[model samples]
Target: MHIVVVGLSHHTAPVEVRERLAFAPTAMEKPLHQMLALPAIAEALIVSTCNRVELYAASKEPDTAVATLRRFLADYHGVPLEEIEQNLYDYQGEEAIRHLFRVSSSLDSMIIGEPQILGQIKTAYGYAVEFRTAGLILNRFLHKAFSVAKRVRTETGIASSAVSVSFAAVELARKIFDRLDDKGVMIIGAGEMCELAARHFVSNGVTRVLVTNRTFERAEKLAAEFQGRAVPFEQFTDHLASVDIVLTSTGAPTFILGHRQMEEILRRRKNRPMFLIDIAVPRDVDPKVNNLDNVYLYDVDDLQGVVQANLKERQKEAHRAEAIVNEEIGQFHVWLANLEVKPTIVALRRRFEEITAQEVAKTFGNHKDLTDAQRKGIEAMANAIVNKLLHRPIALLKRTQNETGGEDYVDTVRELFDLPAPAVDETPLEPLDDDTDNR
Candidate 1:
């Protein structure tokens, strides 16, 4: 069987496409069980995140398995196959292994240095294991991916900076305030991006958070999730003077806070420093407000520039991480190639023993004059002959176990000896070039 990956990510598909194929965390068991029930799949793992939705599986026919998963994805989500197939990407064998390692190492992330993907993958793997959908190959493959991720994290500075816009905003906040431990933050919108930035501030030790939105209940819901207070929309600026940071991402067409409004607000607080991040596309705050003394305003483009600069820094370390993954892939491929070595030896021995027993039975039945003792001696001699004849070939196979084309050696031995091919529940991944006619 081959290790195959089939799915789409933020790189290949937009959010709408990804969402259609997404698997909810709480609803994984049924789909996992269904995946294992497919003919081509042996072991299965599904990773669904905001940025990607991918299915990894072990199967004898990589193409067939990929097709099966593609159909499964559309059918399960009640989406038309045409809608998702165009966005899907697939990999097989060594390439599949490389893709998974890159994903675990965060090099495949939309934001290269972002660290959330590794944990998300781990959680997905946990679900597979819990549901018993992940068998031998997948369990081993995911474990290797995790170890590679750990190595990348410790050995490279890939995740050293803020790669996401929300995170960049937080880093800038830290830079201005020296520390966020006692800083007050006010979020003027309850949108996803706004909430993410607020959560980052809270996580980074912001002392307080106050959320406000056009719909006051949405503000209340988001504020409760972050363990913060919710301020009414009209009265939100009443506490703006008290906050050291402001994040706004509302959909309002006009500016919510103007330069004139901020001038009065700044006076009430004695021109204290305030960091304002306008992540909204429509511009939540008036551009002229930026000129106010002690007020630093940054829009989405500025935050993206920070993210871009950090991404460039991360790109430098990505080479080191890629090298680590390449090294690990070689090690894993060796282990995978060797899976057939021992099983083939055992099957070959069993085949020889079976041949000897059948021949002995035929000879004993024909020669009725032979004594029981003589028959026993003949059987012992036959067993020794079979063992001695097979010893050299078995030893040679073991010695060359780490060499490429070890499967070739096994296949040749089976064909020369006319032995039945070793049976396996799931095939370990093999490079497609070396994957022909092993059976």
Candidate 2:
């Protein structure tokens, strides 16, 4: 059996399509059960995130399995097939394995090397395990993928930078302050962009959120939402003396606070370092404020530019990450190929021994005068012959374990020797935890 992946991703579909296709995390148990119930799918797992949704499966007949999954995706999501057919990208065999490794390693994310994808995949796999939809191949494949991702993180600096606007703000905040717990944030507007930044700060343990808007009622509403205090718009400038961080995105066309006003405010606070993030399109704080001492100002463009630069850095680091993935893929592939090698060899030896036993019985019947010592010598000779004949093929199988067409070569030998097919064990192929299995 081979691994297969049938689904869509950020590279193949837009957000509109992805949202319609995603399997909600809270409601995935039934979907996983439905997927595993399909005859073509031997094992199944679903990974759904904001930017992508993928279905990883294992089957003996890859083509049939992929088709079956595609049908399932459409029917289950209640989406029209024609609308999503062109957005799908499927891979089988080694390519499918490589795809999963890349995804788990975060190389396939919209923001390359984002740390969230690994956790997302892990969560999905956890659900699959909980539902018992994943067994053997898929569990092994995902575990190896996690190991590869861990190696990549240790070996490369792919995720060492911030690549999103909100996260970039958080990084800058860290650089400005020794610790966030002591800092206070004053949000100047109720825009979604500023709210995200505020949330990031609050999540980082900035407990004080002083919200102010033109309308006190709106300011009070937003402040209550974050469980903080609200200040009147006229009184915000006075409270500026108490805040260390200022986040603003308002409808004002001109600068609300000039350098002169900031200088007076800084003097009252003994010139304590202040961070200003003006996310407004028309620019909230005056550009001259950047020239003031101990004041750091970052506008929307500045934050986005930093995010873009970090993205480029991530892209460069992604090349190194991909190399790591390729190396891991080779090792994992060899392990998979060798999974059936020992079993096949055991079966072949058993088959030869059975044939030899039958021949020996017939020979003894024909030559009734043969002694017991002669019978023992004949059995030992048969065993020696079988061992010598099997040595070269077994050696070749081990040597080509990581090479192309290794499984096919093993299959040809099995058929040529008329060996029985290996029994299927749905239990996870145990990981390399044992002393002997470590190889």
Residue range 291-405, candidate 2, lDDT tens digits: 9999999998899998998889888888999998888888877767876776787888788889999998999999999899999998899889989998998888877767887
Q: Which TM-score value belongs to model 2?
A: 0.83
Per-model clash counts, in order, read: 1, 0
Model 2 ranges off by over 4 Å? 14-41, 46-53, 61-86, 114-120, 123-133, 153-160, 213-235, 250-253, 268-270, 424-439
lDDT of model 1 at position 165: 87
- Model 1, 317-353: lDDT tens digits are 9999999999999898877767768788888888888
Q: TM-score each candidate.
A: 0.65, 0.83
Per-candidate Cα lDDT values, in order, are 0.86, 0.87
